[model samples]
Target: MLPRGRRRARGPRPHLLPADARHPTGRGRADGRAGLPRRRHAAAAGRGSAPRGGRAGARAAGPRSREGRRRRAVSDFARVASAADVPAGAARVVNVGGRSIALCHVEGDAIYAIDNVCTHDDGPLGDGTLHADRVECPLHGALFD
Candidate 1:
């Protein structure tokens, strides 16, 4: 037997999936072996469905394809507060789309908006210190631009 922290050596993994496993048609099991023929979902199934000629084809579709920069450019901005509401070098948490956003105003009279949750551990970013153009999360001191 090996020591408590040591791992046991194992042989090469099996290449074939179990024949009876249930998954989308033609998809492989956890073993990476194809169990059955893969099936295609309806076009209206949205994002989860394969895009046209599959993932490889989507890469060649360019930025003009759906879900690209063109789709992101359609966002319309709504005024959350007056410029003076957030003084220079200050930040305020604004609730939008059911999520808290940290609206920051820096020295250059420039305003920036970012998620209020820290990427580190979902800590509230609005409660953190506002530096020049970054916000430091209070819980972990993780910096976000």
Candidate 2:
């Protein structure tokens, strides 16, 4: 006597790929691989053109070493917000030149502008706690002076 319910059979396990097939190169990602398959990019596929600033500058402009690539100052400055909007010991987030910036107002009339991202975990520094002369990240408690 079986219960009045339907049952399903188990399916076969999927095939597993070999270690060499999983990582085409013997040196896995643990070995600090730098190069990527050109086919993955549109430039390599002939759909788009290569990067500008030459190879040396392009390589140095990565997320790890952005300061290595020199950039000219922007002559034009877009007024993001008024100084009164960000009171002293407080911060405000603004967008300028297609970038997220943190506008912090220190003591007196001195105001500081910095990237809104935390360097430790790339978290939003705009939502951090503002101290006397530093901003502390809410996620990992990393302070930015």
- Candidate maximizing TM-score: 1
53-111 in candidate 1: lDDT tens per residue?
A: 55735554445645465333445576788888888888999988687888989778998
| Whole-model lDDT per candidate | 0.74, 0.73
Clashes of 1: 5
| Colliding pairs, model 2 | none
lDDT, candidate 1, equals 0.74
Q: Model 1: which residue pairs collide?
A: 25-37, 25-38, 26-36, 26-37, 26-38
- For each candidate, give its TM-score against the true structure: 0.50, 0.47
lDDT per residue as tens, model 2, 22-74: 44565445233334332577665655554554563454454443556456545
lDDT of 1 at 40: 62
Model 1 lDDT, residue 100, Cα: 88
Candidate 1 stretches with Cα past 4 Å from truth are 1-75
Model 2 regions lying over 4 Å from their true place = 1-76
**Model 1 misses residue 108 by how many Å?**
0.9
Deviation (Å) of 31 in candidate 2? 37
